[model samples]
Target chain A: MPQKHLVEIRDNPLFASIGAESFAALTRGAYVQNFPPHTELITEGEAADFLHIVSTGCVELFSIWQGRETSMSFQTENSTFILAATIKDLPYLMSARTITKSRVIMIPSQDIRGVFERDSMFAKSIVSELATCYRNAIKTAKNIKLRTSLERLANYILKLHLAQGGRIELELAVEKRRIASFLGMTPENLSRSFAGLKSHGVEMDGQVIKVVDAAKLEEFAHPNALIDG
Target chain B: MPQKHLVEIRDNPLFASIGAESFAALTRGAYVQNFPPHTELITEGEAADFLHIVSTGCVELFSIWQGRETSMSFQTENSTFILAATIKDLPYLMSARTITKSRVIMIPSQDIRGVFERDSMFAKSIVSELATCYRNAIKTAKNIKLRTSLERLANYILKLHLAQGGRIELELAVEKRRIASFLGMTPENLSRSFAGLKSHGVEMDGQVIKVVDAAKLEEFAHPNALIDG
Candidate 1:
């Protein structure tokens, strides 16, 4: 692997605490490649041969059943995917596709497991990283089960607002259709929901969302840290 | 803690591989207690002080929002809840309550982190257990997002049938309402879905379910290992 790519992967919390020798072993067989937008990277049920980290651009995790598909999540730079499957030696539960021209690093699963077995610090980091992933999944479940489409969209907007450092104007990174699927809504419903939010001081022109009044949005969204964070 | 309780909890994958000295440190401050049915053990947003293991009977992890409550999952003997929160020293994302008269073992979160830092074996086990949890949650998200209500019910019945060793007759351990909530459907929709499944070889007499034709149910359910396992 290139030195820059190794440094990029090392910056992740999962690899930040590892000793120099173990880190070298981890990236010894690792390789990086750039993918075109909308490229299929991996399919569900395939053996997780490599742990993938998004070095640049975007990767979307999705699942399909009986010709019906839903977006699970989106990954950006420095974020890893299929870590659990690679660690468990199981099939990938969700498929990964690039949403934009992206650079991704592929580390062999055996290398990850080897270091994990021999290095206690790497093992501890995996525990913390996996725990964080598990908690995030639970929160997604709670958000889907306990809220309506309107409430979900409102909360999502509030989340993006906070993520962008409480900016009054924000841009939607992904497309509308993927956002619709991620929020468990149809494209039509997402449009209607956006229209509905206008009454709460949200105005959108194309993909640019302008939050006119943060206080009004918060009052209506009721974004709870337990679920939103 | 009682010797029997210690034995029961040790059977969990999270603690099965720890050293004796680390295990002793883990259980030093642990204690056991019994909770009556419907008793709320911990509420969401509260600091996770103790890691809970169900020693006997049943406990249900659930969440509430805007007066609407949803069941996340049910735990029987030997299963733990809010583990991610305990490991992260964060607030409980979901509240837990007993579904029946249940005995639970409570271990301090600090002790778990303490042993985890000192024992690589325990850390490795934690990696495996947490990976299983994260994957399970992903499967659940796929099931909820990709399947319809009728399909969800059919697949759930097939899961129970397979879980009971292909038994012709199976039993529902939980009430219909909780099952409905867990499946992300209203009670009325649950009854209608059950009625719809009769054509597919599933017959229900109260909580007892009879899978008269396994092949027919599987054909309808179309259970995929990626989503159902």
Candidate 2:
């Protein structure tokens, strides 16, 4: 079963450009394993040996300094994490944990980096992936640098609303605390931010959020594709 | 003159991986020119056509939302900017300006992406550069998410101190207002932050800073190699 799953991942967009021989080498000893919630797959400042892909459920990437932690991002199904570390054979800067019971594929980083040199197409894909990741990180940085907590929350809810088919009302896809962490705010502050946004047309009742005026909220949030995307 | 400068850039660590032929292709029409301080070189949301390298002086990357702008980072000599945008052929998310009279090299992005596919070594160089940028951005994000303005200022001073041969007294390389923007704080808050760090062993008078007790300041800053590096 693990072998079958490994073979299938070759078609994953991340590996799509990988040649047959290189892909086989990368997946040779790859395995699918399931973990319970809160599983720590990788640790910060430690060498990462395996490149992880979430086959099901969510993986949270976070960092810590002086006993304080912050969520960097989340990877969903079919998404990969720690590729840059895997490619460079360096210690991971962030620790990754399972946000829910997760099925993850672990492929040896040695094999991956080794194959990087032997496969031209695979190398190109890595460049593209790295570029995309770099751009995405810049966008996230802008969210923190350019917006207030209230503006950040309003824009986030709008994104979720659009993603959920433009519904006026919607429940959060993740826990409020996790969302708060992801948005770079305290849970208490996030609660207050919700109240702050009430004047901006956002009403939060438990997990359900209703945007009374989407245009008004967007104008207040100034959701630019360059910053938010 | 442009040919001489282009040839020198081929020796930059960033282009070290490119084969002589590929490097020649990349620098075929490259030009190195000087710009005055505060000269805006690139704008957010505009298509990026050239990959810029700071040959001398400094280049500042900044972003704007609504009408407010925040400094993103500074690219010093030998460093490249807008690389991801150049490689992806996408619009830049941050605009760049010169902080001082600067010499910069501009290589057409078309030549870069075209050469990227044809040159294996150049491709590897790009993958490495992108990975570095990604990890560096993550570190910056952690700084914002985990530390207070005072902590950020202390750490920034410590880094400068270490870079300046562990001098007890140090001068900021850039204006405090620009540093404040880069650290996600206002000039007024930055002033307060500097004052706040006095108890933590930092003594600042205008642009001159002295770390009275490095250990005390380090303790307060809780400088983590993972984030600060």
Candidate 3:
């Protein structure tokens, strides 16, 4: 059915230790799907029927309340999304939509449960992945609750620089508005915050950012106050 | 060994469909210990060595930043803490301390790894629990970032009340200062906020609170606007 998606589950460490036969069974039940940019893949409060693996492009995970939306996370290549809801068969707490044209592999949740029932290694991997996710989310929450909006933006910029090998030159992966939402700030405030960071040796043009003084930026960001654990 | 503390493992629903025998073997190597209030059961950034099960008393989980402390969660009777860090054998992101005289069963991380290696059902349970913890943490994060300080305190009180069957005769398990920190506000702000709530039909004496007008408080809380999912 639809060229069977050539499941690359083996690349995922969660299934790396599982027996090849079980992996084959998982692949047999999986299929590939492609969506255009801005396509809503998973909606909040909807039943989770499949575990999604992003093979290309970017996806944003976000939640909405009272007609207002906030970005929770951004998922990119080689990452899986919605595992928690899929595993529990619970309604999603956040919606996921493609930010760019994307390729994804879809694995039925029932098959995932079947594999977990039969494969200890696979199950262990799932547990480890979930734990790592939980730890990261806790860190994000701490950052949001303990730090001010400007602090969040500063730290987020530093993180992106570090993630991009200690430099930010090209256009950013997402818009300032999306990034502002991700940092829990209003877009106007984010623009003003960027202006505030200019005195701290930060510069941006369109989507491109440059940290002119890394040390000064760190001082302004309060590196010691930023969560590393 | 400290009167043996009776370290029996049960197949709690949180652990999925794992059988009692599997749980027994998983905990066969576990050890039990008792500690006085304020004991630091686990510290942030330390290597996770054991999965702790709280059998008696409450434990407060918190993180510190720039010398300011914020409460992450509180674990009470019949609950497990830190499964996420324990499963991955990663450093803990937060520190945990006993709030009252307590007993805890510590299962060595090595034994847990062995159990995962040998038991599929137990592994599934671990994944399920981790997933639940992750989702709960996400919900908490959404609650904090998307709501105002006053709304947060209102929902916090309402949630506690609901957890106690929509009545507030019971004492708050935490101090007002700790509650303020947990709600990401100062003690002074919390005091002022509580006073403001009196006009909205909320009455409190020390830790005991009574919502004289549930509908009015809910209206003030704007639960639908505050919750993400």
Better candidate number, 2 or 3, judged by lDDT: 2
**Which order, best to worst by lDDT?**
1, 2, 3
- Per-residue lDDT, model 3, residue B59, is 89
Better candidate by lDDT, 1 or 2 = 1
> What is the alpha-carbon lDDT for the whole of candidate 1?
0.92
Better of 1 and 2 by DockQ: 1
Q: Write the per-residue lDDT of candidate 3 for residues B1-229, one digit (tens) a residue.
A: 3323433346344444556565666567888788999999998888889888888888888988777688888888768878877777778888999988888888887777776767677777778788888998888888887787888888877776677787746578778887888788899999999998997768889888888877887887867422523
Candidate 3 regions with alpha-carbon error over 4 angstroms: A1-7, A168-170, A224-229, B1-8, B11-29, B222-229
- Taken over the whole model, the C-alpha lDDT of each candidate is 0.92, 0.88, 0.80
Winner by DockQ between candidate 3 and candidate 2: 2
Q: How close is every model to the real structure, measured as TM-score?
A: 0.99, 0.95, 0.91
Residue lDDT tens for model 1, B32-69: 99999999999999999999999988999999988899
Model 1 chain A worst lDDT run, 10 consecutive residues: A1-10
- lDDT tens string, model 2, A166-185? 89999875688998999989
lDDT tens string, model 2, B107-152? 9999999899898888888888899999999889999889988888
C-alpha-based local distance difference test score of model 3: 0.80
Total backbone collisions for each predicted model: 0, 0, 0
Q: Candidate 2 or 3, higher TM-score?
A: 2
Instruction: Encode model 1's per-residue lDDT on A1-229: one tens digit a residue.
Output: 7788888988999999999999999998899999999999999999999999999999999998989999999999989998999999999999999999999999999999999999999998888999999999999998998999899999999999989999999999889999999999899999999999999979998999999988999999899888899
Clashing pairs in 2: none
